[model samples]
Target: MRSLVLIGHGSHLNGESAGAVYRYAELIRERGLYDEVVEGYWKEEPSLRQVLKTTRSTDVTVIPMFISEGYFTETVIPRELGLGHQGPVPGEGIARVLGGRTVRYTLPYGVHPSMSEVILARAHEALPDLNPGDTALIVLGHGTTRNENSNRVIYQNADRLRESGHFAEVHALFLDEDPRVGTWPEVVRSPRVVVVPFFASEGWHTLETIPEDMGLTGEVTVFEDHPSGSQTVYYARPVGTHALVAEVVLHLAEEARGASERGGDEDRTHAEAWHAFMALAQEGVRLGEALITPHGSLYEIRHALDEGRPSDALTTVVTPEGLRDLTRQDEGGRHRPVHTFRNLPRGWRAVLSVTDLPQGVHNLYPAVVEEGYAHHCHSLRATPWPTTARRQTGIYAKVSRATPEQVEAVAKDVCSRCLKTRLWAGEKLPRTFFTRVPGAIPCPEACTYFIAEAREEVSGKRSQGGHDHG
Candidate 1:
């Protein structure tokens, strides 16, 4: 069996950061090329460390959904996947024999040559009527001085676009380094300008920061009385969110799969764990806000609040992707990154064959089945709050400064908002930080959202003259 895993850099503040990755995974799954297609996130649940546990395939190819080969691609991902410190192999990625399976890691999607086509397509689609010869195109990236490769792909694409001669002028801009995005008004001399974000997904950067920095009022911002003489600025969506990204991912995975050497028999750990979960589901199981009930060979999952309703009465979803979209938001349309949140909207049911239950449950509450099985086997590792906090840097570094009382306060506040049973607690927090419901989903550590809130509380207290034990 073969599998494809798409890794993304999810966000604690914005749930939309992983949206493109999930969409791409779903699109690829629809093609029925691989036995399994799953998604992992660096900052979200079903994280890079745990995603492999959900795949039963012997030949697994992992493609980072990021736009560049930077810190995450080079260091963090390998570390999380237990792939050791092996370096890339020119075109083919690091291949290793892991737990009786052949796992091949591929470069990020953005570095591929086909991405230039995606960028051009997005630019043209944004303003089909505009003449490319008269408009200047700017590719925006989040460049970092720490990793030169972070901006390398953006420059390469800009050069490619210049070679295409489709645009009158092409410029590459970064959010962190030189020729910043804010200087786009001065950098391009064309009467019409198109700015395409080279990042993955629409998050705080694309949705909020980039627009504010570029002085863009909307998708098509027109400046009637500007210093550049009535310039019209057209902003395209991030290149990574384009539909062609799924094709790029498949190409990357197929390339790695062809180069990979088949090894020992497939590991049955993940498959066994999944089967065990299915066996448990046969009787009936409550996972977070979802209630799974067996109906002979098939199973029906619905919101716990809608347990009494018939499947036909609720909004029925047959595919895992459809169920994922349906439950991505709450009743009021707020994004729910923490899927185990108690606020699952009422009157929605998912009908799945036994074969589809794994993906279906994963979309509803990621890694719940695998983690639950590990917990049952007494092998699940939970990261303590202090350990998770000490690993934080940058804006979240202040989280380590939180007092015991402040830590407990933040834990209580955040846990109350989530449905998962906390398995990791601080020194000050009791084992029962919150009442653990029977069949409650497991939270192995303090989530990114909780950490962000803790950082805010710590920073606020410090500003208010709170004593710093550190």
Candidate 2:
């Protein structure tokens, strides 16, 4: 009997870590794809090494049910299966001389483009009204700086989904990397949100860590009290647990069978594969700059300047003084408070000819996003704001004429005291520190320390908590 062993990064803490893996294994076994379909786990029994011994088949196919080509896929799996190498051969898919039987290892299923179909399905399943034009789809990933290659597939998939333009925005959020999952919501200018875990299986990260951090309770949950409306934040199941992944596994095994028959001459070694993947990733990043970057996106424009490649497309630089001038005289005959508009397309004209929001304000949205998913713009400055070009007026502002040290002291006090109290009380504080006066580039470099609750009474339009004005 040809044996198939599904290796999962089982959790000692989350008993459900291996639950999906076992379920899929049974599904595959019932199809008679392999005589024996058993699971091995790193943190659960039977251990990978021990499980390999139990496989009586001369032909054994071991699949790593992970989302990336990380340490687990390349190093740990080979070492455990006694493949006698630190690296794997990509596209070859077969390991010879492993415990005197032919072993085949498949590419991490998460990398396959087919997974996008499953993600889209999950989003649609959770939200039947999921509109790509207005909803932001965040593919939450387990990005580790450990191996730069660990998240290539994640970025690729995110971009892949973005290319479809299904959601108003599609971005990858890493638990470990910038644009972390915890605060992406604030940056997303969407009326609806759908977060799909890029993990192979449903476990603590998907079940406990994500929902707790996101202030979510269940799948297809609603994030009410949004300033905009009762917006929905759809939480989808892990991509791996999707029924289609079994087909990906079967496809990988079939490819391995082909490579095993052909004798592995054309395959690149694991190190070579990593290098190739890196080169591809870097090249993709280079090309990605042109397409996804909307023209008037000040964040990307600043990023270019910071990188020393200020784009010619960024000709209209709105300085701090320019912003103050714009704010002084408004069409409403009232001085409009500083608000922010981000991810603006190049062709988008300013709605209200107002002052230039501080450059620091541009950084704020990106910081919240780069930090991770947040409540759709949970108010740090005050409840009066808009992510869209539609600006809200008369936000209570506390500008500081004090020196930088004074500003820092106030910020420290608010951050240290009020933030701690709110956190301890299990209330979610805004994931960002406010640091700018509307329209004015103040004497102090960073001095907007508005440490109000996540929200205060704005008006009948919005309340202390709720959706952002997308």
Candidate 3:
């Protein structure tokens, strides 16, 4: 049997990226098509090197677990894995081949031929309570910054879906550029529309930003694009987890198997591999929010995630001074505290206006796995806060990637030692240092320092004598 290896751009904070890939791997293995079906990632565990070394299969098939085929498929994976050109043309493959294996790398699942059906299927599955006449189908994609080619994949499918007369109207929107969500309602003809994200994982954009802007209400937090109360918006899951994707991967594996059986000719295997890769590329699409890892710098992880190509979208949430100026004045006629502003230090404000929240049409993230997910504009804690937007907020953070032994030793120091007294320069401190400041950027630039500080504070105290330290 053939071997299948699926790789994802995973996240430590989001938990959904790896979870989606694991589910896909389990489905593929359950089919009994390959002698081995494995999962690997660009970030998190079961890394590229580890997965390859452990598989032990002389003949391997690698498929990028992504929603877009722009950079990761083109440059990053090949460069890092020593892969050459993917198809069957002579001298087209990468120069450095690893181990003693004859390998094949397939295109991303997004570009597979079977995706059209899958898209239609996903839409139908997400909106079971719908009539075609009243429903508008909007296909949302992570619009790219560096590559113009990324939007084409999503647009192609939206055009085809529209031509098929599947819904009241079919439109495509991107997260990166203009013709943004704020502008969507002006163009839509239908009174109600369902948006489906073409993303690989359920991360920040899908869970938070899109719904907040669109004014949607739902039950499951993971699937946040459904209509709120009488709100008409609807959302579907990312295309990666669709059932047809499994068939696409299996089909590519079968083609590769056929090439192998005919003869061990490198050209033939390469040719079949190339088609699969191309198909995968056509199906893939990406947006701006990226995966960051501690093993690499922000720039390095960005390169690893996008094949060293400059993104068409902004990499980080850089809230400029101009943007911060938009914060509303308090009822006391003050501009509010400077600490409430993000990105800036001390006291500054960024203010953005919700000028037009369209009624009939709504904005949504391109990739969502469920419908009826909900989020509220709440405070970071359950404690009530006096603000224009009032709702509870949850913080996301990564505590440790260090081994268990290292974590335990640090725990010991904090429990027993009165380490909170120790300061940056041996001065006294308050507990607020350990807690996050309200309205600040969730992750500081020096995230590593935060992790280190938390570990040291807890472990250092424990080592001394079970003191309730900060």
Instruction: Assess candidate 2 and give its TM-score to the true structure.
Output: 0.51
Tens digit per residue, CA lDDT, model 1, 324-392: 889877898866767776788888888899888878888887877777666666666788888878866
Q: Estimate, for each residue in 1-470, the C-alpha lDDT of model 2 and write its tens digit.
A: 47777888765334445667767886897798566676776654445544554454566778888877877788766765667656544864656655356677777777767888888888888778877777988888888887887778888888988999788889788888887777765666677899998887766688898888788878766766766667678888888889888887877777773434332221122223223323332332111111112223232223211234335534344453232233222343332111122112232111111222212222122122111111223312222112111211123222212334433344343334221212222334332221211111111112121212112212233232222220
Note the Cα lDDT for every prediction shown: 0.78, 0.53, 0.46
How many times do residue backbones clash in model 3?
59
Root-mean-square deviation (CA) per prediction: 5.3, 28.0, 23.1
Clashing pairs in 1: none
Which structure is stronger by TM-score: 1 or 3?
1
**How far in Å is the alpha carbon of 466 misplaced in model 1?**
19
Better of 1 and 3 by lDDT: 1
Q: Which ten residues in a row have the lowest lDDT in candidate 2?
A: 436-445
Winner on lDDT between 2 and 3 is 2
Q: Whose TM-score is higher: candidate 1's or candidate 2's?
A: 1
* Ten contiguous residues minimizing lDDT sum, candidate 3: 366-375
Could you give candidate 3's per-residue lDDT for residues 1-470 as a string of tens digits? 34567877654233344667767776887787666676666543344433554343556777777666666676656543556543221211222235555667766667655676777887878778656787787788878677776777788888888888778888888778655664566666665677777776666787676766555565222222323322366677767667677776676555542235432223332234334323322333121121122221111122123344444442332222122222222223332111121111212211112221110001111101000010011111111111101111111122333344544454344322221122221232222211221111211011112233444443443233222211
Q: Which stretches of candidate 3 lie over 4 Å from their true place?
A: 12-15, 85-98, 129-132, 219-231, 255-470
